[model samples]
Target: MNFANRIRRAGIRVPPPARLVAGLALLALTGSLLLMLPGIGTARPLRLNEAVFTAVSALSVTGLTVIAPGRDLTVFGQIVLLALIQVGGVGFMVLAVLVYRLIGRQMSLEDRMALRDSLGLLSLTEIVVLTRRVFKVVLLIELIGAILLWLHWRTLLPLSEWDAMRYALFHAVSAFCNAGFDLFTGLPQFPDGVPNDGVTLTIFAILIVIGGLGIPVVADLINWPRSRTLSLHTRLTLFIVLWLNLTGALSMFVAETLTAGTLHAAPVGQRFGLSLFQVISARTAGFAGFPNLEALSPGAHLTLIGLMFVGSAPASMGGGITTGTFLVMLISMWSYVRGFPAARAMGRTISQETVRRAGAVLTVSLVVVITATYLIAISHSDIAFLEALFEVVSAFATCGLSLGITGDLTLFGQVVIMLVMFWGRLGALTIVAALAMPRRKTLVNYPDAQILIG
Candidate 1:
């Protein structure tokens, strides 16, 4: 038999989840090797671990890094990093399907399923339409952002026109992709290592917020003008996202103000501005308004951690338990306590399967974070428990905010962080489901039994 028939005879099949994980892993490996190639690094060749870590971070769109990208990598290397960020932010399968459509090639059933899973859609009905929409929308937003940033930065920063354009494009993509690769470090104007200017920070925040709103939600929003109605999912996602951003900004401002910490040194209005930017950044964008995160009070740290843990919306350029999952768990718990039979939101009852899956995701994520924290704490004995936990949560959430401990991680600790980043990117439920064996339905039904109460 030929290759295809031979594989069919052998009953070889890779499930969609396996394909996703495998595809991303393969891309990461290729990226790492590319990063290690000559001319990719500035002075000397990059070490294996550094290459691997950077590659994974880029592909996962996680901003944690052992080495500084702008300082250590050449222009070619930065381009590769930018490409990975774009691909990772918009699912690779999305771009693949778009290409296939452009080439007038038909996609197989397997391709459709993979795309569906990648976009986190429940149905495959609008796979092609959504793919095209995502590509067009992403590019348009990035283009507008780049133009605005270029116009503003050219006047403000001391750089050549070409350098200004390049920086604008890079920051625009990074912000929209929620990839926190920045070249402003060590700059004379940006002593804080990030943009403190109102216009630049506002542009970055807007891009980050839109990017994290999820592809499906964006599509729904764009179509809402014509349809004149919003789906329950879109409504709930918007509400919760707005609520979280406001709450996080307010809480961080209060905490830091109370302790006279990082925000205390800033002007009254500027303190809230810093807090708002960092709060927005905490949701999977790693941009910091100030250089020293360690100077923040314990309350501020906790607020950031909580925001990171409950990241952006589902199927967005972010990683965490996700807003949908977090909201589901909260609603489920509140319903149970109120003696309600069903979890309700926005006048709709969420299915039991969704509630169960949310619980599973939360449990698995907690286990991963707690276990990783324990390992990092033990492996890097010099790191304090809170710092260790922050690092673990940041990795697991793929938020990339650090207390200056990323470079200090030992090999073992780095490995743990890498695995957590991978897990966060692929999602706990996706990985668990992919690794599970095929399920066989049983005709027999067992009688319901009482379980112990919490």
Candidate 2:
């Protein structure tokens, strides 16, 4: 038998969940090993915790880091890390499957099902086409983003042609992946004590918005003509994202303006730019123009924590409960308030199964964050409860903005955050589905009883 046939035969006995879990585990392991190579960084073999943490962060497309990227790692090392982020963000297996299809290789039924699950597609064939479209979409967006960024950077930095090209490419990939790794050490605040100008902040914001919007939504928008109406998924994502962006900007503007003594004083234009940048960065992109997280008011910090919890859209480069899940819960709440029998959105009733899944995702994500916060607190009591909670939520949402506590995290704290990042990226449900065994149903049906729920 051919390799595909042999794999098929083996899969006949192996459950789909096992295959999914095995695939993700294998990818994570391979990504970790590759990132650990000596060629990847100048730092001596990384501490076990550091290596694992970096691996998880990159694989999750989270920008959290214990070490500075440009200073800590050589060019070669940065490239390897970037590659991991790209694959992890797009999904390694999904890309591989797309490659096979492009070359005219027939995908086995098992493989199709696995791809469907991984990409969050409704059907196998549709997923195959969607995967191809996603690949094209990513390439187009990254290419255009890189060019625009390069044009903007060329005006700011006086550098050799090659160096400028490298910087542009690196930041472009990082921004597009929603991975907040920055070569510029001093952020929000410029290295030479210069303020972040409007142009740089605006470009970065656009990049973050594009990256955080999920691939499916991007695909739908790209093909909008045929389906003049946007899908519920797309509509909800846009609405939630706009609301959050505007609210976050306004909140930061007021908070920063009021506490101008705490944060560095800037002109009106620069202050607005800084506020917008920091707010967007907190949501999903960890890129910060300013390093003074301690300067923000307690209210701003709390506001950031809330935004991180909401996170980016589903199947996007960023992570969180996902806008879709959040919207579903909102609709469910609205229905209850209106005395409706079912949760509805955009004139369509959400299936009971979808509502249940959203509830499960939210519940599990909250539990993970709370448990991690408590654990971190036990290990590092010096850190305030709210700070610990913020850090945990940042990890769980894959939003890497820290309260200036990353490098100071205890080894135990690092491990806890690493687990959160892993869980966030793989998703609570995906992990649960992977762990669950296949079930066989019997012919007999048991009577159902209603339980009181508050």
Candidate 3:
């Protein structure tokens, strides 16, 4: 039997979750091996830990790095990182399906299922359509972002027009992928200086938001006229995203103003803008113009930790427990408090299965984050507990923002964070499912037991 027939006959199927895990593992391992090569960059061959860490970050699109992007890596290295970002952001399995379609090959049922899971589609047909639409939207958004950035950066870099174009394209793709990789050696600001400019910051913010919105919601908005209604997923995603943005912005603004002694004494407008940008970026976007994490007030740091924990929406390039999962938990809590039979949102009742899945995801995420934070603390006692916790959340959320301590981590700590990033991107559910064995169900019902609750 051929490959397809063999895949069918094994009684073992590659579910979407399995495919995603396998694809990401393969990509990450391959990228790590490539980065280990000598002479690939002007800098020395990355240490094994660094290589693996970078690979995991790129494959997870987390953007956490021990070395600066433009300065440490050569053009070739940057290209490899960029390719990994694109693959990781779009998902390797979805890209395979797209390639199959482009070559006039029909997707198998298994393939369709994989695509559906990767894109969080409810049906195989919808998955196929979503794949096409996602490609178009990503390309259009990235292209537009690149043009705008290029216009802003034309005279800033001491390079030819062609070189400036390349920089613009690179940063644009990085932002839209939520990769957080930048060609600039330091901060992401105007060409002339480190001063935060409205044009650059606004463009980057737009790119990050578009990338984090999740493709399904974008597709719904694009097709709104004909559909006339958004799906439950889209509605929930929008609600959570908007609410988080508003609250996060306000909280950060307040914290920054109250703690202004620790913050650089900037104009109120600039401080507010920085607070907003950092708040949004903390939610899995990973773009940081400033590296002064140590300078932020305790309150601002705590606020960021909360934002990173919540992270981005489901099926988006970015990761975390996900906004949807958090929203589900919140709704479930509200329902329990109100004595409702089931959780509901936006006039629609959420299924018990979804609620259960959300709980499982959140539980596993918490376990991983807490456990990893503890491990890192054991390995690097010099780092503060709060900073370690922040780093753990950042890694697990695939939000690369650090408390100025990532580079100071030991090998064991780096490895732990790498695993966290991988788990975050692939999702706790996908990882758990991949390891679980398939068992045939028996026609038996177990006795129910009630437990006492607090």
Candidate with maximal lDDT: 1
Worst 10 residues of 1 by lDDT: 1-10
Tens digit of per-residue lDDT, candidate 2, span 186-288: 4332453212567766777888898888877887887898878788888888998998888887787778778663454777766666777877877788877
Clashes of 3: 0
**Residue lDDT tens for model 1, 263-336:** 78788889888898898889888888777999899999999999999988998889899999999998898888
TM-score of 2: 0.91
Residues 1-454 of candidate 3 have per-residue lDDT tens digits of 6665777788766766787787788888899899888765565988777888898998898988887767677778888888888888878876886788889988887778777777766766567767787787898999999899888878755667976787888878888888876777442443422224678878888888888988778878888999799888888888888888878877877876776634447777777777788887889778774546667778888888888888888888788888989999999999989999999877889899999999999888899999999999888979999999989999998988887788998888888999999998988888998888888999999999999989
lDDT of 1 at 344: 88
Per-prediction TM-score: 0.96, 0.91, 0.94
Which has the higher lDDT value, candidate number 1 or candidate number 3?
Answer: 1
Model 1: lDDT to the true structure: 0.87
Look at candidate 3 and tell me the lDDT of residue 163: 63
In TM-score terms, candidate 1 sits at 0.96
**Global CA lDDT of candidate 2, please?**
0.78
